[model samples]
Target chain A: MSLTADDVNKIAYLARLGIDTQDTESYAKDLSGMLDLVAQMSNINTDDVAPMAHPLDQVQRLRTDAVSETNNREAFQKIAPQVEAGLYLVPKVIE
Target chain B: MHTKTIAQLAKGLRAGDYSSQELTASYLARIKQHTELNSFITVTEEQALTVAKQADMALATGNAPLLTGIPIAHKDIFCTQGVKTSCGSKMLDNFIAPYNATVVEKLDTAGTVSLGKLNMDEFAMGSSNETSFYGAVHNPWASNTVPGGSSGGSAAAVAARLIPGATGTDTGGSIRQPAALCGITGLKPTYGRVSRFGMIAYASSLDQGGPMTQTAEDAALMLQAMAGFDAQDSTSVEREVPDYSAGLNNSLQGLKIGLPKEFFDDGLNNDMASCIETAINEYKKMGAEIIEVSMPNLKLAIPAYYVIAPAECSANLSRMDGVRFGHRCTDPVDLNDLYIRSRGEGFGTEVKRRILVGTYALSEGYYDAYYIKAQKIRRLISDDFKRALQEVDVIMGPVSPSPAFGIGEKTSDPIEMYLADIYTIAINLAGLPAMSIPAGFIDNKPIGLQIIGNYFAEDKLLNVAHQYQQVTDWHQQTPQGFA
Candidate 1:
């Protein structure tokens, strides 16, 4: 259950985080140690066990489909780092 | 006086001893004086004063609720209308929610004055408040030590007497662990007891908002206003919320308390064990019965919680892409960069680590082996609580294995930090109600005794905690330097 440096790199890439190459070795070691602890779960017999999602067995209730809120575009966009014409502007995606 | 409890304050307000404006002003002054603790993310002084004035008018008309005009703080996790709901992450740092969370609305309806939003672990991911984008909260008891988190700010604020009471969300040990470390009362009610609508989701299944206060009765009083069925939150229970404050004085006679043998085994520190034993002995003298019970699956709680919590978090946090809302990258050549840079820049280190682990666990090839397997194990943990509860009315144990550790004690070692939550994570996994009450002090530091109950057993848990407070003065004791 050892996590290789490659595995750590792949995970970091997927998460979009830049980890220093020097730290990768230590992170791999630490992650492998954590995986070893997590690996213990494989020993338990769960053949008949049902996967529990919610704490209660009840069904989710539905609210009316009617609109409870009005458009507050100005108020909503006030927190954006950058915005114009009721549109959120991000980095240019096309050439 | 600043030290008065919520009940006392409410009584005083009723008696015209102090107006809501004065109380609100006192709390605002305290917040200003205690800026070194970094307990608050934002303080709503103008809004608080306006609310206080309205409360004073209501009181003059003799029509105020029990919690009317009492100053309180909300965990940043709960969304407040027109207030920034950052969840301590950079992604939503500038995001002000348009709607109020159910808990906040309920408290506002009760006429409670809002002091501000408290700090927390980013997306409620870490145990220590250091993960917060705002800054870490210092434990009021020991300035150098961390106030245990992700509810660190709420606990520190309440314990420091900056606010009489505050709200906190517990996904893992967020509320109870911090409350224990900060020497206050924090309760995590049954999963469906409190509505989660508008509460920024970390792990939806485990997230619940409750009260962090100076006494069990105060927790109960706040819970009374916070808990109920909400049509907005599909997961909210339809069952009536019992009057939690009504049974605070109930006799503890014939109450069966189960002491899980596993909780007291190795890894249980002597000081914490002694404090718990003393508290249990006091309960015994007050006519309560204690029986030893076994829950073998207790050892698996941490592992199971790690899997389930992250798996859910991976899905929940995916919505933070640099598209509809939240942080965005400055320049992107393509959509992929937009997504990647936005997330990389927005999330903190611990949050990114969790998102990676969760994404890996739920990935195409690993779903069955990790995510699905953890779900099955989650059921076993819940069943363990059910079986143990059938034999006893409540389960008692140490909230954390030890008192507040130094600020950097386990910051570098994730495993060591994870183990700190060993005693508290199981309750969240089982979706049961639990509370951390100030048991006693060890080496001049505070220790907490955990009381766990069956689903919707908040009333009983509070009763036990309240009765314990009646016999002991531990909750009344404050840290020396701060006082």
Candidate 2:
């Protein structure tokens, strides 16, 4: 259950987070410890038990498809890192 | 004026003992004097005075709301329009919320003047306040001790009388643990009891917002305004919010109190256990019948919680990329670079640890072994609480294992910090309402008596804590310098 350096790199990449090279070893250690703790759950028999998603087990409520929110594009985009003409500018994703 | 509880302040405001403007000024001054405690992140002095004046005009009309002219603060986790809602993360350091959270809106409508946002663990992640991008909040009781968080500032401010009351969110003992450590009253209402519309999401299923105050009576007043249904939050309950203060003075005669055997086990500090036992004895003197109940799965809560909360947090926090409203990195060559560096730079060490753990748990080939298994264990833990509550009106236990530890004491070890919440985490998993009240002091550090109730049973929990506060003066003892 020990997360090696390779495992840390894979997980961090999967999470889209960049871990410092020096910190990767420590991350590996911490993640390994957490895995050990969560692994304790395997000791119990949950074969027939259902996975509880919500505390009250209530289903997500549906609402009408009609618009319920006011447009606040300008207000929201005012704090964006890069925005031009009401569009958020991001790094080029495609050539 | 700052020493008075919310109830007393309300009475004084109505009786003209002092103007709301005067009261707000007094509290603002107190907050300035105790700045060393690091309880506040953003103090809204100008806005508070303006709101205080409006409250005075409303009071002059003779039909002002119950909370009108009262000064309180919100845990930075809540969205306060025009005020910085940092959520204790550099990611949101520069982001100003465009609107108020439903809880903030409700309390504002009740005419409560907000002092400003208080500090918290970054995105409500850690047990102690150390994970905050803003420096850790100090417990007023002992200057060097850590204030239990992620509602450390709310608890510390209320305990020091810097503010009459403040709002706090509890995912895994965020509100109750800090309240226990700071010697104040904190209530974590039933999941969805308070709307989470504008509150930042940490663990969606388990996160709940409630009141942190000096006394249960004040907590009841705050909860009355805070509790309700909001169409904005799909999980917000549709049930009626009862009169929270009506049953505060209810007799505890015939009360079936459950003392879970697991809570008094080897992990609990002996001295702290005696203080809790003494509080329970007082409950017995008032005609409460104590019944020993066993909740064996209680021991498994921490592990299950670490799995589920982080898994949800990892997903929820995925929205904090560079393009959106929060912090963004300098130059990035591509989208992946943007996402990775922004998150890496924005999140703290503890937050990164959680996100990584959650990502691994929910990742390919490991989802069933970690996430699904943890959820099943969550069900077993909830079942344990359901069975125990069936035999008792409410359950009693120590809120935290021991009193507040020194700053940096448990920060190096995440597991040790997580274990400090053993007593309070299970209630969140079951979605039951619970409260933490100052029971007594251990070596001048405070310990809280946890009162847990059935789902949506906030009134009962408040009554239980209120009755105890009536006989004991522990809740009244303020820290020396602050007083």
lDDT of each: 0.89, 0.93
Docking class of 2: high
Q: Taking the tens digit of each residue's C-alpha lDDT, what string does model 2 give over B369-426?
A: 8899989999999999999888999999999988999999998888888878889998
DockQ of 2: 0.87
Point out the worst 10-residue segment of candidate 2 chain B by lDDT. B411-420
Q: Give native contacts recovered, as a fraction, per prediction.
A: 0.48, 0.84
DockQ of each: 0.52, 0.87
Give me the displacement of residue B346 in model 2, in angstroms. 0.4
Per-model TM against the reference: 0.96, 0.99
Docking class of 1: medium
Among residues 3 or more apart in sequence or in different chains, the pairs in candidate 2 whose N, CA or C atoms overlap within 3 Å are none
Best-matching candidate per lDDT: 2
